[model samples]
Target: MTAVLSARGWTGSTFRSLRTRNYRLFATGQVVSNTGTWMQRIAQDWLVLSLTNSPTAVGITTALQFLPMLMFGLWGGVLADRYPKRRLLIATQSCMGLLAAALAVLTLTGTVRVGHVYLIAFLLGLATVVDNPTRQSFVTEMVGESDLRNAVSLNAAIFQAARLVGPAVAGVLINAVGAGWAFGVNALSYVGVLTGLLLMRPAELYPSPRVARARGQLREGLRYIAGRRELVWPIVLVGFVGTFGYNWPIILSAFAKDVFHHGAGTYGVFNTLMAVGSLAGALLAARRTTTRLRMLLAAAAGFGVLEVVAALTPWFWLFCPLLLVIGLLGLTFNTTANTTVQLACSPEMRGRVMGVYMLVFTGGTPIGGPLIGWVTETYGARDGLAVGGAVAALAAATVAAILAFARHDGTPVSIRSAVGTLTGRRA
Candidate 1:
């Protein structure tokens, strides 16, 4: 009975990419760790607003948290290639867990100040500088060529699934026990992931070569990307969309509270619905063995359309379900764009390549968050969403035009099939 239950838990699909035990272990840890990470994120944001009632201040705080990624991401990519990914991840995760615990203590004791949150947020950002690229490269190391796409998609799916659980629980816990309790729960959540990482069979992990590149290799990474149209364009797309449109949660949190006059519980439900949509999108991507550029392009456009609809919807209750659609199409575009870049890059260049990819995805936020905040503060919440959607639409159209002019002969992908794959419609 025990074996049967265990087998049922690890279904054929769960283990599809887990012939490598290392991946299975990593996935298990991530499920726990990522959920905690999301919980902490929600708690932190709420805590910030509780301390400082300014929307601009919250945006600035978000900016500080991501600034390290913008400045040090290339260096982080270099570090990933220089060190063991698993070792780096273990250390980073431990540090982050401790940081959460410390914050919990401060907040619970009523000694927490806005300045404390800023300092801690900056430190956490610094840790993430190294953590993000290492984790991205680690995926390929675990699954190899056989199930790389599946692993990536599944990884995203779990992240979104945790998104659903984390904020909901955090909202309830914050209202009941206090925000400190949410942080404590998050601190505890890291234990499961850390344990999974430690218990993984080392032999099942893929061998990664620590290549010695010349000093000033950041420029080299830039030059490498400059020459590849296929690689560079998608990264650009992600940067624009991610920086602006992808900031729905942070922006919408304020909108829901200040503009719509909703409670924290309603805010949690809004995020939960978006997560549901995101999970569906990730699962759809996971089922596909290959990705197409056209699909990514179309999904990008669809995301913009959904965002516009979400922004224009008059009532809070009416706006909620549109967020789910936005989440769905947004993930579809994002995952396809991400997987395409990974599959296209050579192993030697994966870390650096993904660094630039992440740079665009994350780096845009520092610029976009402020702009969106300004719009939300000055014009209104609807204006912020509408403007972001417009930017996304334009970016998508630009990609379409490029696809029309470029010779895609060298690449396995073309414009038509790519669009069909993204929409899941007939080619």
Candidate 2:
């Protein structure tokens, strides 16, 4: 009886966020849409590789896809604070659907060029700049602050589950029909999310206080982060890892073609395996009620170590399992950092805080993707992977040292205190 009760308790804690109807709706819709998004990502990367047969070109395509976020992500955060998030999501989601459809048409018509791919990628990035921060901040409305961490972890799980399914399906589709149909399928998947958004009951939402129009709001947000060590350290860690560590598309593409001599099917298998670990990590995170900086740092360091091990593995089979461990550690780090940052910020500043977070996390991709690609092309895929792993491990070590030194020096600085101060009042 005790064991049965413990099992039930664990299950309930793992899914507590789903008790909120709005979050349930959001999760259901995201499962479908996220799958479709992953499908497109796999198809797109494969298509780019096929067109140019150059890993560097693949890197360039990735750089273009995320460049807009580097430029407009902060302003996108500003818009999130100023506008209704649900309404904004509808617009962004619609535009993304249209863009996916356009890419599908281009691919099917046999008129697709590298330039066309580059342009569409850039446009999609523009939409993402607005979409990311709003979506990050929107969760508080669905489940309120009490359930925000659980909701975020569940969302990560949903995304990773989709990643597991989408790539495998995309690989089969790409192998059987072509990449065009995968894009078409992705375009249609947007309807699920839009429908979910439209169906939400506004009365059920716990709407956060919106900031009024004010000059220098962006600077205000920046200053808010600067004053908080908890926020600053996590953001800095993410920037380094995100920029140098997460260029998987480039790394995987090179590995698939150059190292493994495999086709799209093999590439998809690799992604699915990685997602398995990520999904596990997300579920583990969901079971916990709190986030910790130590967990984030340890996971980041583990992720780097695993990547290096994977790079050194001579056999494709050996390398694939290492990616699973890497995925687990990477997702654990990301979810912890994401939850910590969101919970630390005031609701009014959540949008901008998330915007800066997303900007640093993804914006660095433009610089890192191309550089990693060039490295893979010039040296080898293994060497490129090694470099990324080393950088991530070193970054984690650096941050850990800083935190330890501060603590040992009798500094009153603490993440708990930083969070208390940030969320205690509006910026």
Candidate 3:
């Protein structure tokens, strides 16, 4: 009896699910690769800003990087469903690594043109169109349903934890070694994730049966979401928050330099501080086994409200701490929404569901970044942040009202119970 009990206990260990070996390699590789990814992100944004000294140019670069996701994410989802994710990821990651290396070479040689940046940015965005859904869905293939939720939260935790370290390190590296070095590091970072994918045991992977690739697959994913009001509403909330509200950094970057009267080093510190709060939120999320809708709604509200306060503050010190709060609330909302949507869908539909999820969540950035950039350019940074927060808050409120009406009609999203799942407390 003791032997049986011991076996059962061992089976339930958190890392036990990773005993599959393939997942262990995948997770390990992701950690290293994701850190490099973050480093490049910091470097890329800084490089564009230094080259142009125009907020709109930075916004344009950001838009180019995400526009492909908006255009191709749904199709990417179909591919994820219809093909072997491992093979697809190998192709896409290789493309991205090459792009990163090329960009580093351009910048390092002092021959990088703005047009060159724009073109490469667009190509990178296009690759991400394939990469995002494939990667999101790949989590399930790696761990199966038994550990899917934990794996998703852990993925976010790992991503943001890298955020905690990567930006600060990038700041130091950029200041000391030049942005090209950061890009070079990013190119090398792809090696870790690529190696992990190569090492994963094919036999242990969850087999996704290929579906007939069809026209109107994006519509099918949309219709699947529409049938569930809960699912639709959270996605709506994310769309608003991601597109407009989450552009705080872009807005704050301008304000930090102009309104708050600071410099690049100060800008780096602000980002790092936000990462600190975001890391805390991600860690808190990792403790949960299941997710609910109400929690998502509440967190979305907090995310918007915090951004509003952060914008309204007059002093740099006051506003910076508020950005930290905004970061914490934003991650709580984002990670919860991400985990909930993934959990609510059927395993077979996960690729598509997550495809739309990534589309709305990330696709918004391109549209929002430029729009917010225009706002900052026109009205100044403070107004941009305030307006963004206001819009996001209004969207959240609208979704909440729609959700209430849906419940009156005898429909509620799984998110309705999200709060209880995390805290074991009822509102």
Model 3 Cα lDDT, one tens digit per residue, 4-85? 1222335544334455567667777777777788788777777777788877887898889999989888888888888889
Poorly placed runs, candidate 1 (over 4 Å)? 1-15, 407-427
lDDT of 3 at 205: 89
Best by TM-score: 2
The global Cα lDDT (0 to 1) of model 3 is: 0.77
TM-score, per-candidate, Cα-based: 0.92, 0.94, 0.90
Error of 2 at 207 (Å): 1.0
By lDDT, who's the top model here?
Answer: 2
- Listed per model in order, the count of residue pairs whose N, CA or C atoms clash below 3 Å is 5, 0, 7
Residues 241-260 of candidate 1 have per-residue lDDT tens digits of: 88888776467677768878
Error of 3 at 120 (Å): 1.5
- Ranking of all candidate structures by their lDDT, best first: 2, 1, 3
What is the alpha-carbon lDDT of model 1 when measured against the actual structure?
0.79
